[model samples]
Target: MLTSPVDDEPPLTGKMQPTNVVVLGASGSIGEASLDVLSHLPPKRWQAWGVSAHRQLGELSQRLFATGLRPRFIVASDPDSASMAQGMPWPKGSELLFGGDALVDLATHPQCDTLIAAIVGRAGLESTLAAVQAGKRVGLANKEALVVGGCLVCEARQVSGAELIPVDSEHSAIFQCIQGSSSPPRSLILTASGGPFRTSTGEQMRQASVADALAHPTWQMGRKISIDSATMMNKALEIIEARWLFDVPPSKIQVMIHPQSVIHSMVEFVDGSVLAQLSPPDMRLPVQYAITYPERLECPVSRLDTLSRYDWEMLPADPERFPALTLGFEVAAAGGTAGAVLNAANEAAVQLFLDGEIRFTEIVPACRSALENHHFEQHPTLQRLLEVDRWARAEVQRWHSGTRA
Candidate 1:
C-alpha cells in the first residue's frame, strides 16, 4: 500500500473552493473521459484551469465547446498545430501557449491545484514530473512516467509532498481496497481483459493485423494503447508502475486474466483474505475517484445490473502466449535502464507493426532484444534514462532493418 502522508489530507468537497485542474493530453481517450468526469461534477467545486493537445487542436476545440469549459490555459504542444490555432475559436479569457515547455509551465503553475497527466508514451514524463515536484495533487494516467522514471518521481513526491493518485482503473481499484487497512497487504493482484486475441490461437496472433490488435474487447483506447493491450505489454507496464506506486516488491505483485473486466483489481491480506473492487468497465468511475478521492460522488456512468444474471471468469495468464508479461516482471525487478529500454523498444515495435514493417509477434522479441542489450544501471538520473530510451528506440529500428550484428 502507499505510505505517503499526503493521503491524510481532507477530500475535495463541494464546500471547499473550486479545485483548479490541468488536463494534459486533453485530446486522448483518457483526457476525453476526464473532461466528461469534470463536466458532470459540480462546477462550483471543480474547474478546468488548463487543457493541452499535441496535434488535435480541432478535437480539443470541439471537446472544450461541448463541455462548455473555458479553461484559463490552452496549450498546443506541436508547433504545426500552434500555427493553425491563431484563428481557432478558443474560449474567451483563455491564454494560448505553444510548445512542450508550456506543458511543464502549466503543470507547475501556482493555480494548478491538480493535474491530470493523460499524455501517452514518454512524451508526458517531464510535465508529470514537474507537477509532482511542484506539490500538486496528480491524477496519474500516464503509467509510462512511472515505468520509465519511477525512482525520480517517487523521490520528488517525498521531497515536495505531492499526492500521486492513480487514474488507471486497476491501480485505482487496488488503492481503494487498501484504504484504512489495519495491516500491509500480502500481495497486489491486477486483473486484465486479455485483449482481442485472448481466445485466439498463437498462430492467429502471429498473423494479427493492425485492425485486429486495435479491436479491444472491453476498452476503447488510442492506437498505441490498443496495440499494447493486444500484446499484453500494457499490463506489463502496469506491473512496473505498481511496483513503484505501492512501494512493493515485484514478488508481491501478481496479474490475473479476468475476461469480465468487472473485478478491476484485488489486495490480499496477510490472513489469507482478499479485498476486490468490482465496477462496470468504466474509466469515468476511476477518473472521478481520482479527482474527488476519499469522497465518493454520484457518477454519470451506468451502474452494474445486479438484478440480471451475469457470469464472471478468472484465469491464470499464459506466459507462453503473452511473452510481454515476462518482460514486465523482469523490468519491474531490474528497476533502472531496463524500464526505459523496454518501454521505448515496445513503443517503437508497436509503431513498426502498425506501419506494416513487422509482424505483431515480433514486438515482444524486439523489446526483449533491446532490454538484454542495454547497459544495466542500478541507479540512473533522469538524463541517463532519457538517453537509454533514445538508444533503445534506435536499436529496435536497427534490428528491424537487419543492420545490428
Candidate 2:
C-alpha cells in the first residue's frame, strides 16, 4: 500500500548495531542505575560488554544471570593476595580478572567502545586514565579521576581523542546548556543541594553524627558521597571536576545553593543570558545522557514544570564554614601531587569520621594536614602517583591515630 514504511526502511535485522559498553564499579549507585538504563535500551542501541565490581561476586553473578548479558570480562578489583592459586570466577563463558591492574586492562580492552567510569574515589584514577588513553568514549562518574589528575586526564583526552561526558547531574546540566551556545560560556554555575545540613550552623555541624550526615534531603547515594555532601566536599570536588571537564579555571566555575535541587546547573553566556537545565533529582536521567551522548533517548525521569511557580535561590558558598570547599579549590589550583594527597587523605579521614573516630570538623583539618605534608613532585608519573596516594594514606592514618593516642 503506498510503499509501506517497513518496505522503505533499510533492513535493521542485520544492519543497525549497538555500541559495546563496559560498566566499571557495576555494583555502586551509579552502576545500578546504569544497568537499569542499559536493560531498557534497544538491542540495536547498546550492549553491556563487560561489568566490574570491587568485591561483590555473588551479587554480580546474580545480576549477570538476571540480565542474561554476560560480558566478555568481569573484574573483581579486590583479591586475596595470600591465595595465589585461587582462580578468578565468572559465568561459564566469561573470564574473571582481578586486582587494580586488571581493572586498567579491562578498561582499555580492545572491544570496549564506551567505558562508564563509575568507580569511586582515587581508586578510579588509573582505570579512568586507561580508558582515556585507549580513546574510548568515557562516561566519567569518577570525580576523583579528574580531581587527582585533571591535567594528566586532560592531556590524555587530547592525545587519544577520547570524549569525556559528564555523568553527575550538575555537570550534565551544564554540558547540555553549553552544547547549544555559540561559544564557551562566561561562567559555569553548578547547583548544590546544600545537603542535609544546609540550614545547620557551623556549631551544629560539629555536633552532627554520621546518621545526621548521611540523611541526604534530595538524592540517594553511597555512604562516602553522602558524607561529602554533608561537608559540601562534593561541591568542592565538583569544582575540580568542572575545571578539567570544561577546561575552565576555578574562578570561572560558581556554586549556588539550591536546596530543592531542581535546577541541576546553569551556564552564563558573555551577553548576560543564563541557560539552565532543570529536571527531577534523579541519577538515572544523567546516567542515560552519559550512555547515549549526542542523542536524547527516552527515559522515565521527569522534567520540572515551568508553568508552576517555584522558588529558586542562589547564594555564595561560605568556605569558612565548610573548609572542604576551600581545600578543593586549593588542590585544583595547586596541581601536581596535591590532588593525589588531598583525595587520599580525605578518603581516609572520611572513613575515620564515618567510623566515629573523629569529629566532623576534623575531616577538613586532616585533609589540610595531608596536603601540607605532601612532598611536591612535579609531573608525577603513574608510578609516582601511586606512591603519593599510598604515602598520603599512611600519613593520614598516623596523624589520626597519633591525635587519638
Candidate 3:
C-alpha cells in the first residue's frame, strides 16, 4: 500500500514552490491518503489546487480541516446530495462548481499541473481522458479508466507526452522496479492478500455472505473494491491495467497470492533476476510517490524491519476456488472491447452483490455471461467501448433480474 520504500530521508532543503494538484475523488480512500501526503509536504512544495467529492461532504470537510488547506476549486458530482457547497466553512475565495463536465474543467485547468484521477469506476473516464489529452501528469487509481479504455488513455498519453504514474500499490511497485531498466521484463507478478476468503474452499465460498466478502484481510478499502478483492476480480482488472501500463502480453503477467501482503509486486527480467518492491501495506506511500514522482522523498509510513524474523510465503492461486482470476487473463488476451465488457459487467455485478440483489458467488458468473453475450471487437473506438460498457452493465442487470440477455 505504501508504494515502494525509500532508503534515505528526502532532503528538505529549500522553500518549496507550490505545485498545483487536483484530486478528482477527494472523499475516497485513495484521494484522502493523497491529501494526507500533501499535508505533510511544505505548503510551498505542493498545494491542493482543486478537489471533488461525489458525496461524503462531512468526511471531506474533516479532511480539509486536517490539512488546513482550502482548495481553490471544488466539484460535487452528486447534484441533489449537495445543492451547493457554499455553506461549508472555507478559507475564502474558493469556487464551488457543479455538474459532470466540471470534472473535465477542473482536470484540464491551465493552473492544474497534476491531476489525481482517483474517481472509481468508468464514471471517471471522461475527466481522466481530458487530463491525458491536456498532457497533465495523471496519478491514475481509477482501474476502470484503464480497464475500459486502456487504448484511449495510452494512445492519448503517447500523442500528448503525458505521464501516467499508476497509484495502485501493485502497479506502483511494478512502475518503481522497472524504472531505468535497459531490457524489458520477462513477466510481472502482482501480489494478492487473498482477501478474507483466501483459504475458503469452493463450496464454502459459494455460501459467503456480503458481510463476509467485505471483510478484507490486510487493507482498508472502499466497499466495491473490497468485494472485488474477496473475489480476486480486482486483480483481474489490474492484469488489464498492467498490459496497458507496462506494454506486456497477458502471458507475461502472473498473479500469486501472497497472504502476508508484504511484497507489493515483482518484476522478472530475461536474465532471471527478480526485482521486487516491499513495504508496509500503506496506501499513503504509493499516493505520495505518485504525487512526488521522479523524486523519492522520506515517507511517514513504516519501513520493513530487516532485523525481524520473516515468514514470507506465496502460493499459486487456486483457479477452481477463485475463477475470477481466469476472467482477467482471458479478457487481457482477447483485448479491445473484451476489457470494456468485463470491467463494466464486473462493476455492475459487484454493486448487485453489495445490494444483496445477487449472491457473492454470482458476481464472476454474471461478468462471464456479459462478456460471452456481448459483441467482441479487436480495435474498438472510444464510442464503441463505451457502448459495450453500458450494454455489459445492462446485460448483468438483465441476467440477475431474469431478463433475456
Candidate 4:
C-alpha cells in the first residue's frame, strides 16, 4: 500500500525561514534553475550547503562563486581527482569535499534540511534514496528513481519522514490540483505536447532521424530527454512515475494530448468538478512550487493569461499514432519489475536510436519486446530492481546488434 508521511508535516507554519539546501545534479537544467530560485530567496535564511555536478566542475565553481555564498561542500561526479571545490572558504570550520562518492555523502548530509534530487536518469537513484533514507525533504526531479524503485522509495519515505515533492511540471501540476480537495479524484489527466511529431504516421516515424526527434515543440530539454519526448516514451515513463507518486492505480490515470502545452494536468472528482493547473511551460515555476509549498510566491516564472487571445484545443491521445503510451499503461498495469525493465529498455533503445543504430519506431517496440520477455519478480527488492535493469539493458543490446547488423 502507498503511504504518505502525514505524521511529519512539521506544522506547515512559521515565518518561512529558508532551509540549508544541497542540490544534487547541480549542473543540469533543473539544478541551474534551482540555483536561480535560491538566489532570489532571502540569503540570511537560506544557505547553499553544497552543489554536485556530473563533470562541469569549472562551471559549478563559477556558479558558486557568483552566488557569493561559499558552499560547505562541492562535489564532482567525475573521477580525475579534480578539486574545483578547494580554496572556496567556508564559514569557520566548514569543509570542502571532492570526488564521485561525495554526491551520495552530501545528499544525506547531516546539516542539509533539503536536498534537490535533480540528477537525471538511473545515475541519480542511489543519491536520491540516500537523501530520503536520511529523512531530508527531497524535491525530486529524478523520475527514474521512482520509475526503477517506487515501492522501495515509497517505503523509505514512510519510514524516514522524507517529503518527496514532485518537481516534474506535470506531476507538480497534479500535486497542486489535488491539494485541499474534499473528494477523491476520479481520474487524473496528464497533458502532453506530443513532442514534435505528435501526428506523424508510423511510416514517417520509422524514417525519423535524431535531429527530427529532438525537435520538441513546447519545452527545451537535454538531447536524451528531447528524443524521449519525440517518441512519447517520456510520457510513458511518467505514467509509471505518476502511479507511484500519487498512489493511484493505472486505471485511474489518463493521458491527453494538449498541443498548446498550457494546461499541465487536471484532476476530476466524483462530484463532476475538474481541478486543473495551468501555467506557461516553465520549469522554474514548478521548481519554485516544490521549494515553497503551501505558500504562494509574489514573483513567478510565468502565468497563463486566460483573457489574452489564445487558441487552444485538447484531443484524446490516439493510441494508433503513439504506441508508447499504450505500452506505458500496459506496463504500469503489469506492475512489479515491469516498470524497471520497461524504463531500462527504453533508455537503452533511445540511446541506440539516437546513435543512428535504430529507427524511432523501434524504441517502443524494443521496450515492449523487453517487457514481454523479461521474467517479472513479483515482490522486488532494490537488488532485484537493479538486476532487472541490468538484464533489460543487455536485452536491448542484443536486439540492437541483431537488427542493426
lDDT of 3: 0.87
Query: Which digits, one per residue and each the tens of the lDDT, describe model 1 over residues 233-337?
Result: 999999999999999999999999999899999999999999999999989899889999988999998888999998899899987899999999989999978
Locate the minimum summed-lDDT window of 10 residues in model 3.
1-10
lDDT of each: 0.92, 0.84, 0.87, 0.81
Number of the candidate with higher TM-score, 1 or 2? 1
Compared with the true structure, what per-residue lDDT tens digits does model 3 show for residues 56-130?
766787788888877887787787656546567655666677768788988887667899888999999999988
Q: Model 4 scores what on Cα lDDT?
A: 0.81
Clashing pairs in 1: none
TM-score computed on alpha carbons, candidate 2: 0.91
Best by TM-score: 1
Which candidate would rank higher by lDDT, 1 or 3? Answer: 1
**Candidate with maximal lDDT:** 1
Per-residue lDDT over 326-384 for candidate 2, one digit per residue giving the tens place of the 0 to 100 score: 88888777778888898888899999999999998788899899888878976898788
> In model 1, which range of ten residues has the least summed lDDT?
1-10
